[model samples]
Target chain A: MYVYLYDTFISEAKFQNTIARVETRLTDLGIAGKICRLSVLTSIEELVNDAVKNGAETIVAVGNDETVSKVIPLIADHKVSFGIIPIGKPSRLAQLLGIPEGDKACDVLSARVVTKLDLGKANQHYFLSRLEIPAGEYEIQLNGQYTARSLNPNQTITIYNFDSLAPGVVADRSNPRDGQLELIFSGGESAGLGRFFNKDSATESVFPIKKAQIQGLNQDQSVIADGYTIINTPVNVGVARSRLKMIVGKSRGF
Target chain B: MFTKDEKNSSESETIIGPSVQVEGNFNGEGNIIVEGQVSGSLKTKGDLRIGTNAKIKADIEARNIFNAGEIRGSTVIAKDKIELTKTAKVNSNVKASVISIEAGAIINGKVNMSQEAAEESQPLELQDKKEKNNRK
Candidate 1:
């Protein structure tokens, strides 16, 4: 059975209309499910826990990127599958999953094409997109053996769990399920002869790493996970061993 | 910093700014343009352009490398060619099939131009071990 967790922040009219459309489609498709609305008083974790306790076969999120990110870790390790019925603004996660916006997303969910995708962990929190730390000097230890120091003190470091979310930022390689994270370092301002001679002076360094430890923070830096600021500097980021079973569109890019 | 258009370039070209300094392992498939300071190892499938004011101390591998900056430490191996501009100040060994040095470029190390240079430019033991572990 599927349990739909709808975000309460959406407009009442649109929310009700979406629920009705989703129910109609599920009924027409002969899929079993129940709809639950998320409120300020109730936490997403609690709602997900309740769904699991009730033996929900699939937990569907009906909101935007933040909502999906919040629900991911709660159900990732479970045997149950996760689905998304995107509402409101377009999301990077939805785009990567190939889930269409509006009522059409319901159709994709109904298709029930499930794929196992890797999850990234920043300390205790899990993120599906990417994590960004402000530009700074850092000592990075990759996959236990390789250790490197940031030569540029103002370079921004980003760890990507999904390559599509990075858009034009290209790396040497990107395989989300390969149990590795894509680390990108970008920053600095070009000056001197480079500005006068080389029009393309901006540079970026990319690495495909499994585990990384960033040290030498000044305590003012913030770590942003999936577009949300979560923790301070000096954090541990890596790909989690557990995978998330997601219902994606037929032409999805994971 | 990258302009709005360069940041969104579909070619996946990378640009590092002049004021920044980075030390780590960088591997990329597209072109890279550095205008700052970079230490450690850099490997790219496409061209690598080091700006005139840049200072890099690392082993590098790329299809083609255009250096107008200062490079030291390990050898730079280019599969296709290596170009040293007038402002280029290099203090490391270089191995490339083709090498071009403009007037005023300073070199403090050996330059090897031969097919055998490819085999001699293999990554250091640490990088080789890391690659082996990645394959496993």
Candidate 2:
């Protein structure tokens, strides 16, 4: 059975209209499911747990990137497969998953093509996209054996679980399911005539690590994971042991 | 003379400009050009070019290395070749399959061009090693 989780933050009128259209489409496609609304009192974890107890085989999120991020860790190691029907602006995760917005997303749900993907964890929270760290000097210990230090305060560190985030930055070694995280450090000024002309040129250094400990930060530094500020500096980031079974559109690219 | 063709033939995947300073372990798969200062180790599958103004204080391993700057400490190992321009001032052990040094370049360490050097320049399999050994 498929259970739909709808975000209640959207306007009630628009939410009802969207659900009406989506339900009609699902009915036409012969897909049976129940839609559950998320509110202040009902936490996402509670709703997911209830759905699982009531025999929900697939839990589809009908909201934006935040909704998807909230639902991933809840259903990560469970037997239920996850789906998405993006409904808000800035639905980059939906686009990355190749799920169309609105009524088309219903078709994707009905199609039900599933694949396993890796999840990145910082502390207790899980993220499917990437983490953006501000420019700073950091001491990185990789897999407990190799240690590296970054002295440039202008360099930005990014840890990616998948290749969906950071457009134009080419990561040739990024594989989402390969059980490794890609760490990219980019900084420096433009060279020669470009610098004279005020061009933005920088250097990018890439590394593939299984587990990393990042130190050398002030206590107040915040780390942004999936567009949300989750924790402060001196954090540990790595690929989770569990994989997420995700339903994607046919054109889904890693 | 290093021709323009030689400089532009292989595009650098990563470029470090003159104003930046990096002190970390860098591992990647693309060619890199460093015009700034790096104080740690660098590992890449592609070629590495140290520009004339670059100052390096780390061990480096790459497929090919073209140096025209100042390097100190550790060893510079390349699988294919290591070329030092006239402005290059290197003060470390050098190892490669082929080594070329300009007449005006200053070198203050041993240079080894042999098959063993080429094998040592290959990508390290650190994931399988049991003990921690720093490359100095």
CA displacement after TM-score superposition, residue B116 of candidate 2 (Å): 10
Candidate 2 lDDT over A1-254, as tens digits, reads 98989887654675668767888998899876888889988898999999999999999998888888788878876888999988867688887788899888999988889888888887767788788887665667765645544444556777888765454343344556888787776664545675567432354555567787777555667677887646676788889744888889876657
Docking class of 1: incorrect
Backbone clash pairs for candidate 1 read A151-B21, A151-B22, A151-B23, A152-B21, A152-B22, A189-B18, A202-B15, A202-B16, A203-B15, A203-B16
lDDT of 1 by residue, A1-254 (tens): 88989888665775777667767877887774887879988888888888999999999988899888788878876789999888887877888888987678888888889887888888777888788776665666765645544555545678888756454454324556777787776654346675566443345555567788877546566678888647665778888854888888975664
Clashes in model 2: which pairs? none
Quantify all predictions' global Cα lDDT against the true fold. 0.76, 0.76
* DockQ metric, candidate 2: 0.14
Q: Looking at candidate 1, what is the lDDT of residue B107?
A: 89
- For each candidate in turn, the TM-score is 0.71, 0.78
lDDT of 1: 0.76
| Stretches of candidate 2 exceeding 4 Å from the true structure | A135-155, A163-165, A171-174, A187-201, B1-36, B40-47, B51-53, B102-104, B115-136
The interface root-mean-square deviation of each model, in the order shown, is 5.8, 5.5
| C-alpha RMSD between model 2 and the true structure | 8.9
